[model samples]
Target: MEGQFTGADVFFVLLGAILVFAMHSGFAFLEVGTVRHKNQVNALVKILVDFAISTVVYFFFGFAIAYGTSFFVSASELSGAGSSGIFEAKGLTLVKFFFLTTFAAAIPAIISGGIAERMKFAPQCFATVALVGVLYPFFEGLMWGGNFGLQGWFESALGAPFHDFAGSIVVHGVGGWIALAAVMLLGARIGRYTKDGRPIGIPPSSVPWLALGSWLLCVGWFGFNVMTAQSLESISGLVAMNSLMAMVGGILSSLVIGRNDPGFIHNGALAGLVAVCAGSDIMHPIGSLFVGGVAGAIFIYAFNLAQNKLKIDDVLGVWPLHGLCGLWGGIAAGIFGSTALGGMGGVTFASQLVGSLMGVAYAFAGGYLVYGVLKATTGIRLSSDDERMGADLAIHKISANPDTDIMR
Candidate 1:
């Protein structure tokens, strides 16, 4: 029985890792469909390469920083066969690393969407190394790994510690806020607005492709949220049901609020999923519905405000969708996870608010620091000529559809 459980845990975590890994394609396609056709190939290439870099960096440095464990030991110790006892008996620790590394890689994947079209490739890669290796893991350790006694302090002051069942704040919120800093540093894409400061409409290259990306994300998110349990015995049907309810809630709200705009409708689903990540394990399905509905509406309105009113030019609205909504998710977990709200309880509003805000502030500051340094040193944006030429051709030396260009 012990051996059976050990193997099951490994298989479960491994499967979760694969599902989350596949979501990188979702990120790539989402950016591809949102950016112009000329820059589509760059979008795809950036996501794949970012994942590769994130995996390597997180393996070498980020994991150790977050968990205070290193893989520098011999194979026997790593596989739990040695006297260290730091790892599980059946290689479960290694698979756990694979699972969490997928989560870490998501930081760069989220930023890729915001900084698309004009970012220099090498500088962005450098930024990824800094973020995944240092900044993200530091915060991750504080919240999840109990580093610096912050979680204990929160519990002492607020009567409860922060609870992010998944990574609404840790992954999405941090990613979104950091992307905000990068977007500000990069400025609006060329010609995104006129000299008079009025916004210009740059329509997506392919709506179908955009829809496909959303579909892929929605499907994979189940694995993302549910598998965070990391073991078979801890799985919950409640999380799965809440995720489904929230997804539809987002879809329905976006459909109405966005007035049938396909882009809004699809992204609405993501907004709900993002918000529900922190509370899915505890919230009732109905409560999850309201949380998701609100998140869907928030994305539509905030996205419009960011682009039209504020001139932020976050290409994919990642700030609103991930940053703001993820913040809301962290707080909502406190509200919707209460026993008074038909939830399982064990969360507090004050702690959630403080923790969520802390994540946002940290991410924004770290983003500016890292990107600011890179801006001063290596430079993060392409030159004017390169920007005009499109990243696909300028950076990769080929257009997305080469044969079609030749025929033209």
Candidate 2:
């Protein structure tokens, strides 16, 4: 019976890993549909390659940094057959690594959208190595793995450890804020603004593809959130319900607030999901709805603010959708997850705020330092000629539709 239970746990986490892994396709299609046709191929390729890189790096380095686990052992030992006891029975640890690697890889996938058209591919790949292997795991250790006693400190000082049921701050917030630094360093895609600094509109190549990306992400998010429980015994229907309600809330608010703009409406769904991730386990369904609504609005306003007022030129508005919304998710967990707000309790607003802010600051600083150094050394942006040609031709040496280009 114990053996059967261990096998079931392995299968559960493996299924969750597979589902979250599928979200990379969602990320790819989302970027493919958002960027100009000339850059679509590059977008797809980057997501896949970045995932590969993230897998290798996390297996070798990042996972160890976070949990102090090492996979460099005999297969028997790794499978708990050799009595090392370093891993769980039935290879559960391996599947857990698979699940977490998908989360770690999401950092580069998020950054890929922001720097899409004008950044050089190699530098971005190097940035992925640094981010997944070091910067991101450093924080993951602090928050999730209880490294350096940070969560202990939070409990001691603030009456509770920071509560992120999923990776609202850890994954989405870190990725989004890091993307902000990359976008700023890469500067605006050429002609994205007029000489006088007025914004120019660049319409999406295909709205259907954009919608498909959102749909895929929305579907896979169930696994991303629910599987955080890491065991079938720990699973909660509440998490699934809150995710659905929050997604609906985001959709409705963006529909109204964004005046039915397809871009805003699609991304608003994502915004809500991103925000609710932290508190989904604890918050009431009603609180989740409001949180989702607020997140949807935050994405609309903050995207515009970053693009227009701040002139950040983040290509897919990743900073707003993930960074700011993720930050909100972290803090919202405190408010909405509190007993006062109909939550399961054991959370504090101060802890959430500090942890969320800490994530943002750390990610931004790490992003800037990594990309800034890359820019100084090998350079991050493409040449003006490549910018004009688009990333497909400039980097990958082929257009998304070569036959169509040939006809032209």
Candidate 3:
């Protein structure tokens, strides 16, 4: 019976890993559909390549930093071939690594959206390696891994530890904030603004593809949230239900608030999912709906504020969708994950607020320092001539649509 349960745990986490891994395709297609046709290929290439780099760096460094686990030992040791303890779960540790690596890789995927068109490939790759290797894992360990006793400190001070059922702040919040720093450092895409500073509109390349990306992300997110259990017995139908309620709430709110803009409608779904991730297991379905509704509205308002009012050229509004919403998710977990709010109570608002801010500050500072150094030294953007030519041709030496080649 113990052996059977251990095998089930392995299968469960492995499935979650596969599902989250598939979401990388969602990231690629979303970027592909959002950026101009001339830069679409670069969008696809960056995500896949960054993910590959993240895997190597995370395997060697990030995992150790976050979990204090190393796989440098013999295969038998890693697989627990002869052990009969927690380590003897038939190498379930390795499967857990696969699941968490997908989460780590999302940092680059999120950043890829914001700095899409103009950033150079190699510098961004370096950024990915450093981010997944150290910066992201440092925070991840603090929040999830009990590293440095941060959660213990939080609980001691605030009467409860910070509770993130999945990774609203740890993954999405960090990714979003980091992307903001990179985008600011990289600057807006050429002609995204006028000489007088009026924001120019850049239309999406393909709404159909964008919608498909949203669909894929929404589907994969169940695995992202539910699989946080990592075992069948611990999994909650509540998490799945809350995710659904929040998703639709985001959709409906964005549809209304965004005035039927297909882009907002599609991305609105993501904003809710991002928010609910923190407290999906604790909140009631109705509370999840409210959270989703607020997230959808926040995405519309914040995206506009970032792009138009702030003149930040975050192409997909990643900061608003992931960063801001993730911040809200952390805080909302405190609100909605309480006994008075029809939730399982073990959280505090002050703790959530502090933790969320800490994540944002850490991510922004790390992103700024890393990209700032690269900008001053190696240079992060394409040359003006290359920018005029588009990244697809300048970096990849190919266009998304080869039929245009014949016309040229």
Better of 1 and 3 by TM-score: 1
Q: Give candidate 1's TM-score.
A: 0.99
State, as a TM-score between 0 and 1, how close model 3 is to the true structure: 0.98
Clashing residue pairs in candidate 1 are: none
Which lDDT value does model 1 have at 74? 92
lDDT of 1 by residue, 219-267 (tens): 9999999999999999999999999999999999999999999999999
Whole-model Cα lDDT of every candidate shown, in order: 0.95, 0.95, 0.94
Candidate 3 lDDT over residue span 1-408, tens digit each: 988898999999999999999999999999999999999999999999999999999999999999888777778778878453334558888999999999999999999999999999999999998999999999999999999999999999988999998899999999999999999999999999999999999999999989989999999999999999988999999999999999999999999999999999999999999999999999999999999999999999999999998999999889999999999999999999999999999999999899989999999999999999999999999999998899999999999988879798
On residues 18-100, what C-alpha lDDT tens digit does candidate 2 reach at each position? 99999999999999999999999999999999999999999999999999998999999888787878899989999999999
Alpha-carbon shift of residue 39 in model 3 (angstroms): 0.5
Better of 2 and 3 by lDDT: 2
**lDDT of predicted model 1:** 0.95
The reply for model 3, stretches above 4 Å from the true place, is 83-88
User: Each model's TM-score?
Assistant: 0.99, 0.99, 0.98
Model 2 compared with the native: what TM-score? 0.99
Residue pairs with clashing backbones, model 2: none
